[model samples]
Target: MRVDTVGAVFDALADPNRRTLIGFLAQRDTATATELAAELPLTRQGIAKHLATLKEAGLVRRRRSGRETRYKLTPEPMTDAIAWMATVGGQWDDRLEALRSHLARGEH
Candidate 1:
């Protein structure tokens, strides 16, 4: 994934409300902001704002369904972010193993 895309995903996820919204969306195929608001303590407007951030981060997609806008999780950006994290984590793990080996050899 591009660094900026990953950064945006991380930034959008930094908010607890947004994370909650994501969790809600994940359980369904799509949902309206109003519907999501009903499930949470937030107002519909607040839910819209969080959805907008999620859309910008490529985490969700919105479509106009007759009178209301519906949002569905895109998930591709999140998948990319997960792959990037795994790569970085693997590198760190390798480095840590090397350090462990060095320590075992009692090298200064």
Candidate 2:
């Protein structure tokens, strides 16, 4: 993914409600804003706004079905984010292991 796309995904995921929306969409595959609004504390408009944000982040795709618009999770971009996180985690693990080895040598 592009840097801006990664940034947008992080920004969109930063909101708890949006994260919840993602979870809900993942479970349902696809849902209309009104359907999500019914289960959530937010109004339909608020749901729509969050869905728009998710769409911009490339985390969700919108489909139009007659008069209704539905949103669904798109997991492809998330693979990039997950890979980045794994890289960072591996770097930390390497640093921690080196520190541990250094401390053990000092004790000996």
Candidate 3:
């Protein structure tokens, strides 16, 4: 995936409400704007707006069910974001291990 696309996915997830939406879809498969609003503090229109941004970010995909649109999580982008986060965490772990080694050597 392109960098901006990944960045956009992460940006959309930066909001707690958006994060909840993704997780809910992960378990529920899909949700309508009204359904999502019921679970969130925001209005139905606000949920709709967030869904549009998530769709633009490629973190969500939607389908029209008659007059209602249902949103679902696009897990691929989330996998990419998680991998990137893990890489950074691994680097921190390595650095911490090195620090432990250095401190231990001084104690000897």
Candidate 4:
């Protein structure tokens, strides 16, 4: 995934409300903003705003079903983000191991 896309995913996840919405979406195939709002403390407008952010981050997708817009989780971007994190984490592990070896050798 592109850096900005991963950044956007992280940005969207930074908010607790957005995370809650994601959780709700994960449990179902699709949900309308009204349905999601009923499960959370936020109003429908607030849920809509959070869903917009999630859509921008490629974390969620929406479709029109009659008069309602049903939102569903699109997990591809999140998978990419997880891969990026794994790559960075592996690099850190290598660096830490090298540092440990250096210290064992009495190097500053």
Query: TM-score per candidate, in order?
Result: 0.98, 0.91, 0.81, 0.98
Candidate 1's residue-wise lDDT over 6-79, tens digit each? 99999999999999999999999999999999999999999999999999999999999899999999989999
Q: What is the per-residue lDDT of model 3 for residues 1-108, given as tens digits with 9 covering 90 to 100?
A: 456767988789888888877877778978998998998889998888888988998888999999989888887887787877788899999999999999989964
Question: For residues 7-88, could you state the per-residue lDDT of candidate 2 as single tens digits?
Answer: 7889999999999999999899789999999999999999999999999989999999999998999997787788777888
lDDT of 2 at 75: 92
Error of 1 at 108 (Å): 2.2
Candidate 1 lDDT (Cα, whole model)? 0.96
- lDDT per residue as tens, model 4, 55-90: 999999999999989999998999989999999999
Residue 41 error, candidate 3, Å:
2.7
What is the Cα-based lDDT of residue 60 in candidate 1?
A: 97
lDDT agreement with native, every candidate: 0.96, 0.91, 0.85, 0.96
Task: State the displacement of the C-alpha of residue 71, model 1, in Å, after optimal TM-score superposition.
Answer: 0.2
Better of 2 and 4 by TM-score: 4
Candidate 2's C-alpha lDDT?
0.91
Model 2's number of clashes is: 0
Model 4: residues >4 Å from true position, as ranges? none
For candidate 1, the C-alpha RMSD (Å) to the true structure equals 0.6
Q: Which residue runs does candidate 1 get wrong by more than 4 Å?
A: none
Q: Judged by TM-score relative to the true structure, which candidate is superior, 2 or 3?
A: 2
